[model samples]
Target: DTAVSQTPKYLVTQMGNDKSIKCEQNLGHDTMYWYKQDSKKFLKIMFSYNNKELIINETVPNRFSPKSPDKAHLNLHINSLELGDSAVYFCASSQAVQSTDTQYFGPGTRLTVL
Candidate 1:
């Protein structure tokens, strides 16, 4: 009975290590998004997918990637993770951009690099 869940809620790793975070939603949503929240708590949209189709792609580093198997799940993969990537990654779901679509966020995956 989970709305959304991410594995290894808190990840501690050394710089330059590859890592991935899994995300899933059971709310029957047709759109899903990935957001990155920095230490300053500024939330920015990294990617957005609707029915397995990418709807939005913000200017982010190539080291970060997003994959959506279905509209209900969206995962984040990082290559050669760097210390600058250290932040909280959140998985959110929304109906659509128009008509005031409020995003429901997960507990948040905190990534720490040494």
Candidate 2:
């Protein structure tokens, strides 16, 4: 079974539109993270949630928000989406918030804004 998963694996939308990517983990992990891979394939951390609490939030725009309703789920919502938002968003989870902990990544959601 998939340890981590994301919905709407492919998303195509016009600029200014709003979109959300749902993520869930079944590995019984305590920490989840959101990462964005730009067109250049450079992955950057966006947000991190541990035990349903926001622990690390990068310099992401206000338009991007990470919502964790519970320890098993962390959703990404983007408002007024722009061309810059077009990229792959990945959801990951680890047993704990430790550098040495192994993190499992989802298949990733590709967002295309035209």
Once superposed on the true structure, which residue ranges of model 2 sit more than 4 Å away at CA?
Answer: none
- Candidate 1 lDDT over 30-80, as tens digits, reads 888888998789999998888888889999898988889877889888999
The window of 10 residues in a row where model 2 has the poorest summed lDDT is 34-43
Candidate 2 lDDT (Cα, whole model)? 0.96
| Model 2 per-residue lDDT tens digits across residues 85-107 | 88999999999999899999999
Model 1 whole-model lDDT (C-alpha atoms): 0.87
List the pairs of residues colliding in candidate 1: none
Cα distance off (Å), candidate 2, residue 101: 0.6
How high is the CA lDDT of each candidate model? 0.87, 0.96
